[model samples]
Target: MTDTTVRSTGRLRGVLDRIAEARRGDSSESLAAVFLLIATLLALLWANSPWGWTYEAFWHTHISFTVGGTGIDLDLQHWVNDGLMALFFFVIGLEVKRELAIGELRDRSQAMVPLTAAIAGLALPAVLFLLLNPSGPEASAWGVVISTDTAFLLGALAVIGPGKAERLRIFLLTLAVADDVGALAVIALVYTDELHWIPLVVAILGLAAVWQLRRLRVWRGGGYLVVSLITWVALHESGVHATLAGVLIALLLPVYPPKRREVEWAAELTKRFRQSPNPEYARTARLGLDRAVSVNERLMRLYQPYTAFIIVPLFALANAGVALTGETLLAAATSPLTWGIVLGLVVGKFLGITGSTALLRRKLPPGLTMSQVAGGAALSGIGFTISLFIVDLALTDDEALADQARIGVLVASVLAALLGAVVFKVAPAPEGPSMELLRPVDPRRDHVRGPVDAPLTIVEYADFECPFCGKATGSMRQVREHFGDRLRYVFRHFPLDEYHPDARQAAEFAEAAAEQGRFWEAHDHLFAHADALDRDGLDAHAAALGLDVERLEEDLRDGDTANRVADDDIDARTSDLPGTPTFFLGVTGQTPTRLEGPHDAATLIAMLERMATAASPEAPRS
Candidate 1:
């Protein structure tokens, strides 16, 4: 390719890679929630438009199928709720299984605080709802008040920036997951119709068939889908909510990683693929890769995006279109059912969650403070998706009650989000620095970019091969240009060996370059040619930077050079560093403000300005 073409292609590829990285993280969740919100607004507008009757007509239109002298029928709304939502529940089940197996719920002690708080949060809402509607049909709809929408809550937290309340976000997520479990239990036990014994028995047998399939190591996607469909249909016929079948099947799936023997066999197969370039070897290698990961993880990767982006939004579009006439508004404003839902979610969640945390303060996790608990509790009241869901299940026969419940949810969610945002804004920064930049810069051992006595210092723990670190290098250069003599920049090594195999050796080489006073030159060269960072590449760069090639090679072999890199690694671990390109800025004796992620130049400069302003003696303390 020509030079211009190659450069353009490289830039395009860089953009695509960044986009892919974003989709893999919390950004995907945020995007899905945004789409869901948009669908909800469209539904509301459509229902209130001049063509309002079309909204009901379209969603209520029946769709039916028949086979072998039997038929099944459902309206468009019911199809979305019963069929598409089953997939959504399946994804939830996968998340729950993953958490219990390896994520937050893996530790009993760590999970206790949120688990207890979730129970309290659920119970208080039901009590409030019951008090408002004591022996009436409305009393049965208490489940609508108990669920906290995970997507909307997480999306709002992301917008709020988890930097100030990282622990608070964790607490909220755990509480929401626990709340989901409780809500699922309520659906299965409280909302079911009359039981059909034969269909229930058939459903149990289908679950056993799923268990047997896993035992036989049946990994084909189609086989599992067919069996799960059978289980779902049987559960539906049994008069239990078919969505619960998703949770049951997910719990039964194998979550264990490949056994040691299987791993060894995969390694052997990979070696054979390398030796012989045959199709069979390649196919076996692919199978080996698949076998190395658990079924739960594989299925989550396959299904999470579909459920989030498509199924959930369709559910919202079908369910969120409640017409708001003048009479209906007046009734909702005065109705006990509406007031019950609104107050139960908004007031009860905050009181219950915060009260429970305070009551158990002595036994709970040390990371959470009272202010954080309060803020998280406020955010927990932003219940949208699942609250609307339970409304459909609980008040299915009473459209007036369902509309009242929907109105209550909409108003409550907005108020809760606003209240939580205000609480977070006014809350004090948590006690002590969460991250400690403890390693002092030694003039003799460290390579410095600016004056040693500069007012502000930025210490970066980075890996040479990390793309985010490469992006951060440009931002650091901009920071130096903006601050000049006021900033002192220090670099530290933190090579992640699992992801970047050559990074540790590269760090040692950079340290060796520091011995010859060309550390900065080597640093720039390594990042500029990040794709080519082997031993020969390092030597070539050192030569180009005017270092004595012989001395450079000798210094690389010296044990002290490797020891310097190891020291930085130890410091990073001690600080509980999250990832590469993590920045810390402050003066001596005071704790530094820790900034995570690959921030842009403007953001870094803004943070420095804030730090400078805060450090000024004239500045007033809040």
Candidate 2:
């Protein structure tokens, strides 16, 4: 019998995996559906409920960040949607890199369905809206139905059962990503009030400076942040939607490395150290090494919390608030724009997506099942967050229209979410899982053995008896291949001596092998047989690697190698390496940049490129 717990976890796992995967593809609409639902609900409730007046009053209250006599003034809502949302766009930018690099968009075959469906999904909705609203005042608000908010959609799906969750999740995500492309187009073409070329130009220059810094591998978060402020201001003043500044700056960021040049430089640097001649040089080198290590430690501490705590949560809190009241509901239903949006998302999304998917599945070779597509299409209507955003933006001049749109989005999103849950529950699982099962990748080993000069470093720390460590090797190998020399892979020992009684000795065996110029070989052997990392197994691995077993045994007994392994663990812990296969890419010599967990090559490449340019001399000068 299928393990029920496994199935449930698999579903949750699929949701996260899809999020990671969809970040690369432009087709993450399912997530949007859920985000829209929550945002719209919050917005509707904030507008109509008892708290509605308070919410509105609160949002309208102005806040400012001032320096000297100058300050930026914005209402609380503006801070959320414009200021905080920039970080959201930054995440979107990161996902765009992943997709274009190695995800679904990377393959022409995989891309065709989403691109075609996205085009149809977008076009069908606008045409449907035009047919419904005609030339009346509501015509211009047609952009509301065209959006797909990934966060809201996925969040809803998380509540549902998990059978065939992976497939449906993938379908909805790619579809939504397609919708984003169209949404961005609408913003650029239809939304702007006037062109402020001079400030816009300044924004571009600021962005260019950021790009230069990224190329130089300047992993200084503050540096790009300062540039982002200027760019947003310039764009805002330029009569472009200031939020577009987020998108624009995100695009200019360098996400890939400078090819083999950096890799070769690192290897050469390492080789030079191995061949150092002068005794005096060693003393000087020690000081330099110490300084470099300290610099890396300090940089890591500074960057993580700022992005995680300051940027992300602020965006969420600000954007998550929307008022709901009885007056708003009446206003929402009466408003043509909001009505159109509600019907379009709730009804139009299901019809357009499901029908189009069915027609396309019959005609196209690369297609998911109709049931899966239908379930996914249902999920696509969970456009609460982005839908609310567009509703606010689309009907800025007409409060009635905006209120109606929020109601429509909220109601439609809920209906869609419920429908998606029922359908996914009944959908049959295919025999073979297509998307690779994600195995955890260890960071400790990758951290220690991984090169200092390497653009991306993956450190794996593991106990030889740990089952998770055994599973991680395949996943990491795939990463190594994808990144090639761009990554400097490392392996370290944290044998969890308490968990597995003999694992400490096994770690010592691997350390001893490193001294004998065969650390990698022994490292692989230990993990390959992690189930049996006892003395017999380690000894066999040593013998297999053609090491002098007698000498290796003697070294292991002395405990010196074990002490060194302990030091490696201490280093990893100090660096905030979260778990096995925790990754840190120095990106450049300037600072420490870390991406925790089992990340794809694309993220690593993007981080490396950003670091390189950010640290360049031309960065600040520009």
Candidate 3:
């Protein structure tokens, strides 16, 4: 049998592998969702059942310990909330970092709509709650409504059936991250307890230990965990919420190159091998490769299991459980915390997202259409998990008030999920996955490759029928003229069929030209005369570009290009270029920056010159 089959039947058997396989499944989100629903239902059942005594005792049972003449006391629930919840926050921190670095939030324009919507969604609720409960101590927890529960929201979306673009998921995720930033800010500024010196000193020492361990290149995951636990205890005693300790420690932890020097050496070796002249040079690069493999094996052993199967799900189980009762529901409706959260989530989120998005379409760089913005904002109110946690933290002293907030979250979140589902279900489905269009196809193969020799690569996301895209061709040609051999231009379709009916067909015709090595020629011809982009114009453009007439006609009849065009539109959302003619400038060393809309030749040349000079080794002093 093969080693892969042997491993499948290995000594540890299938437990870890099963967990890995489960994670790989798309249904993992659905499972987490089922867990959430079960947890919530169990909380209600436990609260009202004859075994309610057991439930209360289970959560309320206290544990205590003494160290250095100081005593620490906590109930089982507090341990779970203060200790286990910190790990959840750390994972969230990781997700936030990943998104900002390489995921959806990497592009400024891509992030604008969601970021703006999150702000508006947050502001309206807090303002409404504050106005409703002005002087009440319970009103401090208004931040609860500001968060979007990514798992629950996305899971709800998944149930609506397939054919949805990944861009829709990505757009919602960006908004959720924006919501998380808002929530974290609220916790740091508004929810912290008063500082205490003695515990603070201990907390700082714990943090110092973690930093030193990391600096010394320690890759032992257990060491970090032990330090994180100690640090959490110190922070809890130091007057800050213990959960925030996880957030603080996670911020301090380095996620770049691993501690093993061999790993770094292996990466450098890989790069060198890719650039090397001789195949023998690459063949000889084995010892470094072996060392890198060993280091990765060790690192994975230390961290993977604890993070996936334990931390994330345990946080969901503990935090998701909230008592639901008639009393709780009634109190939630009347309480300022409840109404503010409910209205803020339901009314405020939809309005703010839809409104600011509409304004952006008119004034700012470009924005998602009214239909898409409306659908996304409507879904923003699915704030169950995080909202519940904030409510629990916000009214730690008043059990009654906290219960009311939970009721509000349940009602509002359910309403939002239903409404958002209907909106997306009714919204028109585009032709294909949006990613295929954003990432270019290869010339000889069935894929798209970026420019090979140009010093600076300019990738354009365009729709043939888009007037703005039509106007941008001249600007791009001017860039090529100014830079000569220094610039390469790449094209990807981003048709907005919601408003432009002919956009999809126009994109297909361009792809047909691509098959004949006349993509650029057909691109210019079609855009230069967009008003005549119908069947007759497409045929003339094809003939003008010297493409085989019969093949082009046959391909257009098949309509197979729709999926490629649709995929590009979805992928473009992650880059924050929700509209046409969104230009990305990629170079050897510098970061990728997008140039939006139709700029004049002079503006384009100046920007290109700046980018080109920035990539140079010895350019300027000032």
What are the lDDT figures for the candidates, one per model?
0.79, 0.60, 0.66
Q: Which residue pairs in candidate 1 have backbone atoms (N, alpha carbon, C) closer than 3 angstroms, thus clashing?
A: none
Candidate 1: 10-residue stretch with minimal lDDT: 1-10
How well does candidate 3 score on lDDT at residue 530?
A: 90
Each prediction's number of clashing residue pairs: 0, 88, 21
Q: What is the C-alpha RMSD of each candidate to the true structure, in Å?
A: 11.9, 19.2, 16.1
Candidate 1 whole-model C-alpha lDDT, 0 to 1: 0.79
lDDT by residue (1-622, candidate 1, tens digit) is: 2333334333433433343343234567678779888989988999899998999999999998788887668899988888888888887787787667655676667689899999999999889988998878788888888989888887877786336444566678778879999999999999996899998999999999999999998765577889999999899889998889988888878765334344445556666777687999999866775575567766776787888788888888998898989977998999899888888898889899999999888765434578778877887897788888889898989999889989988888888888788877888864554665656666665677899888788888999999999988999999899989888898989998778867887888888888887789889988987876654466567777888877766675434576578667766754668889788888645666678644788887887788777678674322
Question: lDDT score of model 3?
Answer: 0.66
Q: Rank the candidates by TM-score, best first.
A: 1, 3, 2
Two-way lDDT contest, 1 vs 2, winner: 1
Give the higher-lDDT candidate: 2 or 3: 3
For model 3, what is the alpha-carbon lDDT of residue 156? Answer: 73
lDDT of 2: 0.60
Q: List the candidate 1 regions with Cα displacement exceeding 4 Å.
A: 1-25, 258-283, 363-367, 430-622
lDDT, candidate 2, 1-622, per-residue tens: 1233223223333443344333323353344433444444454456557665686687779998888996678898887777766656555555454445434555556466667777776777677766767776578778877877666666566566354345455556666766776787787688786897898899889888878977776653567778888988887778777777766666655443112223233333333444674656555433333222212222322332343334434443344443455677677667666666666776677788877766667543222467767776777776655566666666678766655665676677777778888887788755543221111233433334444455555545566666777776766676667656666666656656446755766787777787677877877888887765544456567777899876775565443574466555555543434555454445444334455544555665565556656666364211
